[model samples]
Target chain A: MIKRLTYGLVALLLLAAGPLSHAQETHTLRLAQTWGPNTPILAETVQHMADMAETMSDGRLQIRIDPANKHKAPFGIFDLVRNGQYDMGHTASYYYKGSIPNAMFFTTVPFGMIAPEQYAWFYHGEGMELMRKVYEPFGLLSFPGGNTGNQMGGWFRKEINAVEDLDGLKMRIPGFAGEVMAELGVAVTNIPPGELYTSLERGTIDAVEWVGPALDFNMGFHQIANYYYSGWQEPGAEVQFLISQKSWEKLPPDLQEILRVAMRTAAYDMYIQSTHSSGEAWSRMKDDYPDVTHRTFPAEVIEALRAATDKRLKEVAEGDPLAQEIISSQRNYLKQVRQWTNISDKAYLDSVAGE
Target chain B: MIKRLTYGLVALLLLAAGPLSHAQETHTLRLAQTWGPNTPILAETVQHMADMAETMSDGRLQIRIDPANKHKAPFGIFDLVRNGQYDMGHTASYYYKGSIPNAMFFTTVPFGMIAPEQYAWFYHGEGMELMRKVYEPFGLLSFPGGNTGNQMGGWFRKEINAVEDLDGLKMRIPGFAGEVMAELGVAVTNIPPGELYTSLERGTIDAVEWVGPALDFNMGFHQIANYYYSGWQEPGAEVQFLISQKSWEKLPPDLQEILRVAMRTAAYDMYIQSTHSSGEAWSRMKDDYPDVTHRTFPAEVIEALRAATDKRLKEVAEGDPLAQEIISSQRNYLKQVRQWTNISDKAYLDSVAGE
Candidate 1:
């Protein structure tokens, strides 16, 4: 069976060789993402764009995706596309905040817009336009890639029983969570794996807030910590598609359209996914960890958190006018997305949690 | 200038709106990875994939990459892709040895082929086909990724000045390197990030090979350890892209063509990226730690090390016929690529390292 598969692959590869440059001449492009198939919000939607572009162009233009990290790393992707390393990249704009602080707003915030809110902000508000401005400096262009509806509070250890627990409590956090945690008196640490386990076992850190359980299970974090928290810190975290300016400019107009629609699809799917699988992972954990307690922060802690989050956000915006503009736009959008979520998301979670 | 960049971004978004989906049709695809933009391997490649898919299909095919821990943690990446949670993912084939022993043949070995040769084996040999077969059981399709060129033996607190030093030393390691370390009489500890520093600081681990200087510099390994070593245990480490079978079938034929070519481009670019930056990072480290010492394992140690590496390779082939098939094909292709490199890479490194 292995041999047969190998032979088939070889044939596929050989057959692949003939269409290389010819496809390029016809403006047919393929984008390879080095990530999980499910992470994108509307992955299927992106795929549809390719079909649309081809039909619209009457088969003159083509776009397809190799979802596997068949080619590059998620972060290195933007530069690759920019340098013509590859034609384009899908990434989190927030990750590039080191280079462009403003780009973070486009993706999500510690206390920013939820999915519907973020989408509205980007579309109707000036969010998308401002985001593009952030990209041009890097010779890149971008669009919203993925979004989780409203996330959990984050996995925790001991209990965040009080705001005092955060003090000197080393936690694995990223982006705005790290910022907000500082306000709450947490010693925020960015501990990538290959190092996380040793630290926790040896008492190097107290806690970490990674994604929902569909992800946490494999990380084997449950083995180390006695507690796992929700994704509350990042209520709605969005991913992004980073496109190289040179590459984006090279594409004919119709090809660009295909790319946009595809992103929208990924966004919608991602929201639906986080809602479904995250619950399953959490349920599994509950059964697995009879001794491990899962508790929501007290209403007081939550209220305090909300206040701290707002303060840190203000500080970030104060750094520049554009950031201020983004913050205001985000607030307006979230105010709207939350109303719908109260019925759609909260109702469902309340019904399920009760059961 | 930054303000203007934002303005330019607004313009692009406005232009993008012209070809909007208008609720009629959309294509969104998920691209997932095990790491962030900082991880030269998975991060960079994922971004490129998203771009390729977007541009090729116009706006019809959009790819959104889930960054490290955005949806799941690192180890979960493979399973997520396998179970179809992610449409695509970046995988370290060998990392899944517990589940698929044959998978190791596709990635780095304790003393496996260095980068150029490894690339030759996978691309020109039957290596790619064999790897696909290994992945087929999990409903995954794959593409070659770049190699982490000959890695440093490790960052050591005490030099391996002799074989005696190898005894009783606890080491931080992953993959085949751990296997080799165990065979070498060292106590291999698979400690993740949070624990590494405390371990090293407390003298629990005498040595570790986290990565090259670029990342090591940030981790501040220099503050704890004094010696930096050569690249031998992992001559060239390979990382790969994984896609769901269902997702792969969803692409149109022309888009598939685009994916194949784009992967080749991504794989080709990864070579220099994973290595060259290290040189610059090391140079910077020198300024930071002028007293830091650089050394290589002694001649006798290197020979024994090489012997162990060769032994591990033989064991892989002997223990599994599938691995044997892969090795034989990889070796043959390597012999051919070596001919061309003999005048370039081989000759250059041979003369310089010898000095």
Candidate 2:
């Protein structure tokens, strides 16, 4: 009889301890990223975020990442995460504009705010709410994953002094920028990444618009193109992390907060990393290829490009109310914020330019 | 006899569970910050960091913050943390230049790199190692706490049209910038924060240099001074977080990572917050005081100021080898990095200014 009583007590004790041990139970999340394996800034940001989340949660939260090669779907991350095929995805929101028209503004716009300005809009202005409105219906939550700072326009084989210079210009540009270029009489072509160098090397493409110097140096465009133009299309292109609502609701509050902060830090870190790498890469490019020249679009060309971009934006905001709302919010916020940038960083840089 | 055997088993079970429960033990760190209680941006950064650490660590790591009012040591945070009176401190490194001359470089310098560039220097360049070397002797670890972005020059009662316009100008500028202004024949004065408005109003000082619009607007300087000039000195002033070596070593790896990431995220968040607030504040200032104008020092004045700044830097670098290495590194890095900045952000901004 005493043995039976002791066994009952042991069972009760184990029950009491069950919840305590359960608190330390591990949860692993599967993540799919659009970038290929070992991609420099973009892939590293995902890994950095995962590492932070894992360490902060004391092994209770693990993130398993599958690059594009593993998933075999570079641009299909939106559908994958939204449908719960993956718990989370790292990709650019603009890539899915065809499927979800309202998604493009979250990435960037032509002649838009820079990195800091866009970050301010997201956090302090109406950007986060607008983003939530767009993604909420799909049962997904989106956060800025990383930034690529100011992108370069392209590596042009010849100078572009006038708007007429773009007439029949064969260029490897993509997305909304390509549409804008097509309006200016440029034959915008989409070439695979592997074929871009040869396309520019041969007479197949007159110009190629990759990322900035950090990603562009590897493309070897500087060796072939003399005019490396400053960017107008994507001033501060920010990629995003999309999480399924189901996966998010399953995590404890503390783990959720951990994931949120890790992603935020990783995004900012990527911007800084891009800045550092771009500086190093640009310096090397200049040293190795002295003929590579930095150019800004002439006033005439910039004006025409801006007009074309405005026209496309107007067309985008035509019927969709949510799209109109996001576009208006960004435009209004940019106007207010750019005034401050103009007086501060812009003014300071101009004053010290002679140095 | 059976009861005694059961009691022995219970004791063993409890012993086995002891380590598991201890792994969840909580640690609370005390932090002292230079800012007063409820100080915007600066104080908020400390609270943000603490909140992140606490949430990420699942209540296992807590940070107790004491502002300057509680600690009664606005300028003594470095010593407080170094001596273990406080486990951590939030303060600008330049505050302790008198005690640690090398510390000033970590904060910022005249004609130094901007925020992104400075961040790159810290993360990718030799900054972190050099910073470690400086603080290692004191048994303290330092990290970038926050940035004020590009600080505004000052609010001037009269415009500076020429290099000679600075002669005998009474200005309430502090720190290294004050020294540079003194070299330019400006009558530099340090007035209490409360007395600054009246002094500038009464012509006791011809100009007053505070932070940018976010912090400066509250001082009511715009009501008195007409010209709000862009900053030349302290271009990207970064405050710091200092931790005692003993306190850092005591934390578990998970908790340490949590603390490190929290500090980093808080730093970047502060920059974004500043950008948001500055835009808002500048807009309000302009609306409330339309006569307030934005100006840049003329090219000649900028040239002269840069010369004075360079001369002072040369003097500082002469006696100390480490200082020379740091100054030289910053100069060389700035030369290489600014080229990239000029071509990317600067060019893009200028191109789109008309829009």
Candidate 3:
């Protein structure tokens, strides 16, 4: 009887402490990213986020990431996460525009707000609420993953001095930007990333629009393209992180907050990293290819591109109430925010430009 | 005998789980901030950081914040944290320049890089290492707290069209910028924040250099001053978070990571919030105070200001080798990064300006 009583007492003590100690239960979440293995900034952001989460949770939360090469589905991350095939995914929202047409607004527009302004829209304006409305129905949660800053227009063999210069010009551009290009009488082509360099070099494509200098440095476009034009499209291209509701709900509150903060920090860090690497890469590009020059498309060309973009946006907003809501929210927010930008950073930059 | 065996088994089990379960221990840290109670963005950032730390640590780590009113030491946060009166502090690095002269560089400089470029320097370039060199000897570790974005020059009663206009002009400017103004034949005065509005209205000061529109909106300077000039000084004014080494060392690895990340996220969030609020406030200022006109100093004035700034920087870099290293690093890095900014975002903004 004494032995049994002692055993019962021990069990009761262990039970009393169990809830408090259960935080030690470890959870490992599987993540899939659209970028391939060892992709510089994008892949590094995923790793950074995972490291932060693990360290902050004392190894109780672990994230196992599979890049596009492992998953063999670069553009299918949306379905993968929504169906619970993976707990989380890092990919661009615009990639899913084929199935969800309104998704492109969240990634970027042809002539939208830049990174800081767009971030303000997301966090302090109507963006998060609209984003929630878009993702909640699918049992998925979406958050901004990273930004590429302001993307360059394209690497061109010749300067675009007029609207007529785009007439039948063979350019390898993609997404909504490509659609706007097509509207302007350009021969917009989709080339594989592997073939882009050869295509531009062999004159199969007269211009190629990759990301800005950091990623573009690897593509070797500067070696062949003498003129790099400033961009009107994809002002701030924000990639996204999507999580399955089931997986998110399974984590305890502390771990959930850890994941949220880790992802947010990683997103901001990627933008800063992009800024750093782009600076370094641009400097190297100029040193190695002294003949390369920077140009902005002429007023005529910019005007045409802007008009085409506005027309496409109008069409996109047609026949869909939620799409119209998202579009108008961003447009109104940009109008107010851009005025501030013009008065502050833009004015300051212009004033000190001669220096 | 049975009872003894049972007790031994329970003891072994508890011993095995001791390290894992020890995470249940809780710690509370006291933080002192430079802002008074209910201060808008600055105080909110402190609260946001503390909330995140608590949530992420599941109450294992709690941060109790004491604003300036509670502590009665607005500019003495560095000393407070250094003496262990407070475990942490949130204040501008430059506020302690009287005691730590080299500390001002970590905040910002006249005609320095903007927010994104400055952030690149801090995270990717030599900023963090140089910062460590500055703060390590003081037994405190510092991190970027928040940014006010690109600060405006000031609210001016009259427009400044040329360098001659600065002659004998009385301005309520502070810090190194004031030194630069004094070099340009301007009368620089420091007034209490509460007295600033009445002084400016009564022509005690011809210009009042407060922060940008967001913080400045509350001061009602727009009602008195007609011209709001773009900034030449403190382009990206970043405040800092300081923690005593003893307090930092006492926390476990997980809680430390939690604190670091919480601070980082809150810092970035504050910048975005500033952007949002500034845009909102600028719009309202224009609507309510239609006489408030935005202006940029002419080329002559800007050139003179830049020259004065460069001269001051050289003097500061004279005897201090560490200051020289930091100043040179920032100049060289800014040269490279600003070139990237010019070619990418600036060029794009200029191209689309007519729209």
Candidate 4:
């Protein structure tokens, strides 16, 4: 009788404890990115974001940032995060053109817009509405996580004296630049970021364009390339954080606010860090590789490349539904802004050049 | 005698550790920002950057992200970070017109090149170099960060059916946009971001144009305004991150590399986060405030706004040495690209609008 009564009491206690334990639930977010432990811009910002959440939330919400390889392959980051295998990820929209064609517009467009124009369209114009339509089916929500204020023209083994130099040049490039380059008779290739150095080192690729001096210097581009060209092909490549819909939906309003704050902070600080590091790297490269050639693209060549980029971007925007919405809104804004820039941006440049 | 000898040995060990403990490598970074926690974009990014250095280096490189108030105020973030009071910060170049009026070119120009064009000039053209020259005197480095893609025209108590609505109206604006609005006969007020909300809410301002639907929704502008319009004043407002020279010099080469990678990751991710959040926020906003009326600026108003923006930008760029350099390099590339975008961007947009 005593044993039976003890068992009954224990069962009751267990049932009572289950509700209490369930009520005090904790959440874990795993954010993935396609970079090594040392990549400064995105990786460092992510780590900082995770730490801030943990500290500010008082450990109630724990976020673990799984660097490029820890969780899965680098390219798989967006899919993994989107499919709910991971809670979140860091990526550039152009990286996944095959899966999400419309994403390219958000990441970048050839001759479409710069950082400010892109930000304005998405943040203020109808651009964001189109973004959700693209992401909704995939179960992801996106945000502006990083910006490489207009990028470099790229690194080249030979001087780009004319549009002819681009012909048959095997260049390591990404996103719309590759499409634009391909359209212009250049052999454009996508180099998963990690391999940019080895490929450049082995001459597997004759030319490449990465972020800028800051990223280029750290990646040791100066060690291999005899020349470091400007990155003009796709100015202002925007990067993003892809968060899982399931994870996003689960967060309380306050946690969501915290995430927004954390992401923005990461965005601002990372920009400074890159600019600082890139500038130093530039100085260091000059000091170390005194023979490294630095030259701007000829005016004619710049015009040709820009034309080709625009031509290719139009091909995609007109055909794709999501791209149509985003590109149209952005392009309208761009055209309107362009007329004014003819005076502001162009007139100023002319004045400076004359000086 | 034995106890005294043991005590002596322990005391000797303790005394020897004193200097080592007190002077433990001594690495601390000052990260400054022109924002408070309430302004999540850059402030949060700054916080993450600091946390990353600490975590990655295992506290060898300690970085503290200081809010604007911690220093003299928001406007001083650039100077303070430059002066080395703080190692790094996120700020808009236009905020401190007094310190380096030319720095405004680095942030943005009214009617300056679109996103891609602006980026091209800065990244590929000599824009970055010129910007560095301007900021270097102040001992700072600036990184391109969050861009408010085409900003919304603005929120007003009344709809902007014509340009006359702007006449004598007090508008909360800054940078090149404010100048353009002034030219358009609007009474423009340059209020720091912190004070914008109260100024607009209390009727100190007649109309206000901030980022867009995403940020605008959170800002609760719908409660006070009946009409929301398109982005006209600022096509793109590019923000930047600044770092101190002294703080950057102290890092080892390897840590420097990490910083670069971190910045790249952070900027890209922030861009994605902001864009995605804005989209979701815009869609969900109606559910929060059904009365939020979204209206496009009339064609005449847009044309006038564009004309005025262009005029003001030209005046500034033509007169300013740094602005001219940025405008020249930026527009040179943009001219080439804009031709192609004519068919590519504009044609597609025309088709979409027609459809």
Per-residue C-alpha lDDT of model 2 across residues B45-85, encoded as one tens digit per residue? 99999998988877889999999999999999999998889
Q: Check candidate 3 and list the clashing pairs.
A: none
Among residues 3 or more apart in sequence or in different chains, the pairs in candidate 2 whose N, CA or C atoms overlap within 3 Å are: none
Stretches of candidate 3 off by over 4 Å are B13-17
True contacts kept of each: 0.02, 0.72, 0.76, 0.00
Ordered from best to worst lDDT, the candidate numbers read: 3, 2, 4, 1
TM-score of each: 0.48, 0.98, 0.99, 0.51
Residue-level lDDT tens digits of model 4 in A322-351: 666676787676654443333222322322
User: Which scores greater on DockQ, model 3 or model 4?
Assistant: 3
lDDT for residue B151 in candidate 1, whole number 0-100: 68
Q: For model 3, how many clashes? A: 0
Task: Give the CAPRI class of candidate 3.
Answer: medium
What tens-digit string does per-residue lDDT give for candidate 3 at B1-355? 7768777767766775565467778899999999987999999999999999999999989999998999999999999999989999999999988998899999999999899999999999999999999999999999999999999999999989888899999999999999999999999999999999999999999999999999999999999999999898988999999999999999999999999999999999999999999999999999998998999999889899999999999998889999999999999999999988888778877877777
What is the full ranking by TM-score, best candidate first?
A: 3, 2, 4, 1
Q: lDDT for every model?
A: 0.63, 0.92, 0.93, 0.64
Q: Recovered native contacts in candidate 2, as a fraction?
A: 0.72
lDDT for each residue of candidate 2 in A35-121, tens digit (9 for 90 to 100) = 988998999999999999998888899999999999999999999998889999999999999989989999989989899999999
lDDT of 3 by residue, A135-178 (tens): 89999999999999999999999888888989999999999999
Model 2 chain A, poorest ten-residue lDDT window?
A: A12-21
The whole-model C-alpha lDDT of candidate 2 against the native structure comes to 0.92
lDDT of 4 at A168: 92
